[model samples]
Target: MNKSTLALAVAVGVLAQQAGAAGFIEDSKASVSSRTMYFNNDNRDGGADQKETAEGLKFDYLSGFTQGTVGFGIDAQALVGIHLDGGKGHHPYPSSFFPSDSDGSAASEWSRASANVKARFSKTEAHLGGALQPNMPILVANDSRLLPQTFEGGTISSKEIDNVTFNVGQLEHAAGRASSNSTGLAVAGGTEESNQFRYAGADWKVTKDLTLQYYHANLKDYYKQDFLGLVHVWPIGTNQSFKTDLRYFDSSSDGKNGDAGYQFNNNGGFAKTPGEVDNKTWSAMFTYTLGGNAFLLGHQRVNDDGGFVYLNQGSVVNDNRRSEEAGGASFYLFTDSMINGFVRAGENTTFGQYSYDFAALGVPGLKASAAYLYGDNIKAKNGTSPDQSEWERDLRVDYTIQQGVLKGFGTTLRHGTYRGSDTGIASQDQTRLIFNYTYSFL
Candidate 1:
């Protein structure tokens, strides 16, 4: 068995011995969540369209720490995905949404389970397991599909100091949102697994209205990246406020990064050194909120040397198989929209969004948002073509039952349209409708 599996077994054994412990049984929590999604992607540029529907069920159990100086507990998760509908031609081969069977068609169902051993001491906590979902500035687990992605690794988070939080982790493998198997970490176009992704970061709340962050990460044999961020909020009145968020990243190649087996695709964009990673990106966003309405504006710039880089295992083929359809990822960026990420080399993008909550209009659980992004001056491959440009527009609406028997039931609808000029990226329109519900058991 793998190290994570063995660790889980040992932790479960310990839990069995301490099943009736005071705090462990008294403060435990359990929940089950269900999601049903209908996804439709229309390729405007002659590619085959993808239309599919699926249902995902997730069960989670979080045990409270045992009563002691150094307490121990466990977190377990089980997920199952059922393919409800997708015709032969609609279910694309090598899809990022569902696993394929022997005939290259969507599989009927798939399932996976994982557990984490956790310990708490004073004001710090540590977790070791295969069901880790981290949401730090350096990494964000993807959950835009029927199921959420997960990582296999160990993480330590501490808030021992007042108004300061520290985080460190080392991730070895990833299970994609639509996948059942785990694969080692790698970048785009990289076929060889790296197996080591280490990161350290800290968030400091300098004041009640201001916060600062810094983080550094390295994927062995791939790339190293550093991020710095600042956020501040100013309250103008009882129901008025303005916020500013600024972020910067510097990334460069690591050992064997430009080698044949460890190439970076630069998100299908132009790269100055071909397969090497060398990038500097920055973004700034401002938001103004008045009552229940909010407006946001942002600008992002990518250096002329290369496109941004992040950990992705989509292209890695493990053991002559494609890692059980392990594909799709998310990056921490304002432009990581529904259809496209305007992160090409030498690209400068400006974006804006408007959102409103219906509670101010007498509706308790309704919200809607509209966003638009325009990018220009994208470097072309080999400098042979004219500079490229792209634009995208997105619309989303969500509602939830605020009361009654299905109080927690929610529904969301999203649509996006993307177009590019002289860029290799595809022009497309995409839409998704999702239904979500959760039940808690203590």
Candidate 2:
């Protein structure tokens, strides 16, 4: 049966049983969220332009566990996207805003639903089926588009240790944020599908101001990766603090990653071994916050072996349908900019941002920020220029209703401009506006 029908069936069955159960109905919660987004991108270097406006409706339900030593519960989600506007060539092939139709146009509307069964013990929990979004350093499910990308997987999380938390799981497939169907996982370049993605990680709260993290992940026949992270926040005074964050990633080829069908594409950048995967990346960010002002400075460096890699399922296209989805990626790095990810081999990037909160001046729920990033010293596989460089600037403003009937309403505006050399990715100026609201229902 379809996901929607299945979700309805599950909801009805659980509610029917809850009439006689103790905790099922008493602890249940449901909510609906709505989002309207407008996107416009102009490629100054004669590249294709993108413009689209869409609306998204999301429903979420969380059921309380039944009384038992190992209580059982369920969670359900439904997502729908309405294609408000995308005229003709605005949303070209492989668009990220919405799913494409059979005739290469934006689909009128699309939807999907999910449900997960979960069990809870003293300090641990297990979840199976439906949606899995692990926000670890190695893998992050993208939620930047109309609908969030979701994975089909089983996960186990435990907080048995006093100051440590653990997460482990295996994902089989993923559904893109714009598509209604799921597909196997694979990085950029290779077309061969890998059905297994296993990961494990832990976070240790070393002290009141410091935390340490470690994670590892492996995609069958693709690549294996390990990550290490450290974060510390030092309070300076009233409403003042200094924060430091350091992250490192080490990745290499796995089973068949060096083979013909499972090779990586190095994100269309330089790969020392053509399709083979081999890279190391590290970044550091320091921030200072005082009163209503915050400033951040960071630097990132990509090793010379190859470009940093991550999962990008854009290669698995299938007739403008299910496959070739899942393109938006959010890596744990400062270089993940709006126009480009400065992850090319042997590249070094320096970036900074400054933000302010209007609440310090009596107006609450309003904020603005601006950031700049400059990258240089990039290397190419074909022995091109060694000093290739690029830069980007972004500005953002956001506000939410602090009181009144529209207390939950939110709006955000963002704009960015990027310029790069011929050896780098195309340059562009992009703008985005979003409005969001949420309401609880029981």
Who wins the lDDT comparison? Answer: 1
Q: What is the TM-score of each predicted model, taking all chains together? A: 0.98, 0.94
Tell me the lDDT of candidate 1: 0.92
Alpha carbon lDDT at 263, candidate 1: 94
Alpha carbon lDDT of each predicted model: 0.92, 0.84
lDDT of 2 by residue, 305-413 (tens): 8888787776664454336555566677878877688898888999999999999999899999999999888876575645688899999999999899999799999
Estimate, for each residue in 1-442, the C-alpha lDDT of model 1 and write its tens digit. Answer: 7776787688778878887889988889999999999999999999989999999999999999888898889999999999999866898888778888888889999999988999999999999999999998789888999999999989999999999999998999999987888899998899989888999999999999999999999999999999999999999998899999999999999999999889999878889899999999999999999999999999999998999998778889898865637878888899989988899899999999999999999998999999999999998977568899999999999999999999989999999999999788789999999999999988
Q: Global CA lDDT of candidate 2, please? A: 0.84
Clashing pairs in 1: none
> How many Å off is the CA of 106 in candidate 1?
0.6
